[model samples]
Target: MDSLSYTPRGVLTPQRSLADLTWLRVGGPADWFFQPADEDDLAAFLKALPADVAVFPMGVGSNLIVRDGGIRAVVIRLGRGFNGIEVDGETVTAGAAALDAHVARKAAQAGRDLTFLRTIPGSIGGAVKMNAGCYGSYVADHLISVRIVTRAGEVQTLPAEALNLAYRSSQLPEGAVIVSATFRAAEGEPGALEARMVDQIAKRDASQPTKERSAGSTFRNPSGASSTGRADDTHELKAWAVIDKAGMRGATLGGAQMSEKHSNFLINAGGASAHDLEQLGEEVRKKVLQTQGISLEWEIMRIGEY
Candidate 1:
């Protein structure tokens, strides 16, 4: 691999271990890890670097599983300089690096209802990238636009329509780094919003293994006719219910197990390797397919190599 020739004000490290940067805490090193000081620094570095060098922009590693073999591309991580949050009227502008929880709390405090983000563990960038939704509300329902840096070092603002957002997915331009996003939230009483968020936290804690090391939901709910036994039924089938029905709840492989508390979660139950977690997930898929005849789709993004 060619060494990166350009240097910017941001911190750059080669062969940086990625295990500590992710929620699941199991991965190999990134060939190059770049923490940009600001948008200008990021743009300049990308403009000067060889066009062949692949760039992967990552947010807080909440819903990701990087393989043990690590990533070959340059991993761009936004930090302090990109975490600002501001509110005007009912619109909230947040930097891509800001946590979804923080954004939700701030928006709620400002009497704007963005409560759907309160329980999500990812950063704003990931939330936008995934069209993250919970409790029936999604980012696609509130996002106004996003400011992004293109792969060729150009800055552009794209409206929400450009993303073609769907259930837990969005079509963002490849290699585009989201710098900031504007969301139009609804007006609400501050006290009511705060109380609602508290209730959500409590509900999540009661239902999920919140203290464990897991990548949120492991699979998406099966939709349409596939979910229902009858072709006329349109209701989605929950992933957890199917896994439970398959008798794979609390199933283990190595140190990885599907959480007993919530069958949808794939947990690193002490000393679990990335391979173990991934293998366990695949096992669940096989069991579900064999017993329920419904193929499950992954909700968590698995990257890098095995």
Candidate 2:
């Protein structure tokens, strides 16, 4: 591969391994891994780089499956420079690299209600991209605006509507990188909010495979009236319940297992490869379709070559 002429006050490496970055701990290397010093550095680097080269911005890699053959794009991972969090009144402005748990804690300390983010094991950028939610509240409900670096290296602050946020998905502009987001949190007692977060954590720990090395949920709960044949209401059906009904609760493929503790979670039990995990998920999907006749859609993002 040819080296580019542009350089910035940041770290850029060739063929950085991605296994260490993701929760699943199974993927090949990225063609180039760039970590910018700041927003200016990121924009400048992007602008100088050839337009034909692909750019992929990643967060903490909570809900991702990078194939073993690796990604061919320049993988941008923000670090210390973009992890700041600030709270003013009822609004919290967080850098895209800031962890969701940290943002939730800060918001609670400031008497703001964003407890739903506490249990999400991702960064603010990933949360915004996925409209991440738990306990009935989503990022879309609180998002005010987001700052993004467009594919052409132009910076823009877009409103929440620009993404057209939906259930666990958003329409981010192709190759755009989210840098920061402003959220309007509701006011609440600091102590009460803290207590609520603690309770939520306890509940999550008790019900899910909290200690396992796994991406949170494997599949989106089936929605639409077609899945349930109920015309009046479109209540989402639980993926876990359906998987359990299909008798795939403890199914395994090599070192990958549909977590016995929580059927929906796909875990790297020990020394699992990306292929093993993905194949297991596909098998579960096939089984669910065969038994329940309901097509399951992946909630976790899978990228890169096979």
Candidate 3:
């Protein structure tokens, strides 16, 4: 592409391996891997790429489950060159590829409390797209706006409201690449924030299998009615509890197993292929549905193919 030459310092690779790019540590090679030098390079590359070609932008893939067959498109992963964090008063503008923990720490250092993002393993882009949240605080709460490059190669700024963000999702266009996002965080003391984050990490480590080869949560809690004719909210219901109650905890299929420690988390016991992980999840879902009246929706994004 002309954009490879357009930026003298950009990183470009033809048919790069994608296996290690995700938290799942699985995926075949990408047709192309482009890490633009900066915003200008990104724009030029997108503008010059053939219209028929597909562009997939990824960050630190925490919430993803890439299939074994791999993605058949150009993959764009922003580098440190686009990972700068700028804090101005209560507002923080961060590059899409910035780690959620890094952004939280930077904001915390500035006396702003974005500490809710302190433990999420994904990047800013994934957080924005997935509306990532913890401890009842979701990205839809603080996001002010985001700058995105559309599949048509045009860049634009959009307010969070325009994204129709809700729960664990956003209306971000499929094929659109987020360059940067601005969020509004409340204020907090650095010391207190750090201490709280430390405690939170410890709590997570104990309750969840933080060291296991697994995505954080496998399913979103089933919401609404309980079939008792009473209005209900499952916000208090734990996915693991339900799975355990359904007798699916510690269930295994090949190298994939529902974690014995945390029934909600699926672990690659060892040599687990994407199919094993996916099918095991499906098995868990079926068991939950049969035993309980609730149906679980996947929280981890499943991409590529079987």
lDDT of 3 by residue, 1-306 (tens): 334334435787877877688777766677788888887778777777777778889887777788887777788999987789999999999999899999999998999999889888889998998788787677877999999988766899999988887667778776889999999999899999988889888988888888888888898766643222122123557678789999998999998999999998988889888888899999999999999978898998887756
lDDT of candidates 1 onward, in order: 0.90, 0.90, 0.83
Residues 33-150, candidate 1: write the lDDT tens digits.
Answer: 9999999999888887788888999888889899999998889999999999999998999999999999999999999999999999889999998888778778888999999999
Kindly list the per-residue Cα lDDT of model 2 for residues 225-289, writing each as its tens digit.
22112321235478898999999998999999999989999999999999999999999999999
* Model 1 TM-score relative to the real fold: 0.95
- Total clashes, candidate 2? 0
Q: Supply the global lDDT for candidate 2.
A: 0.90
Cα misplacement distance, residue 68 of candidate 1 (Å): 0.4
Model 2 ranges with Cα > 4 A deviation:
1-3, 225-236
Native-to-model Cα distance after best TM-score fit, residue 143 in candidate 2, in Å: 0.3
Please rank every candidate by lDDT, starting with the best. Answer: 2, 1, 3
Against the true structure, what is every candidate's RMSD? 3.1, 2.9, 3.6
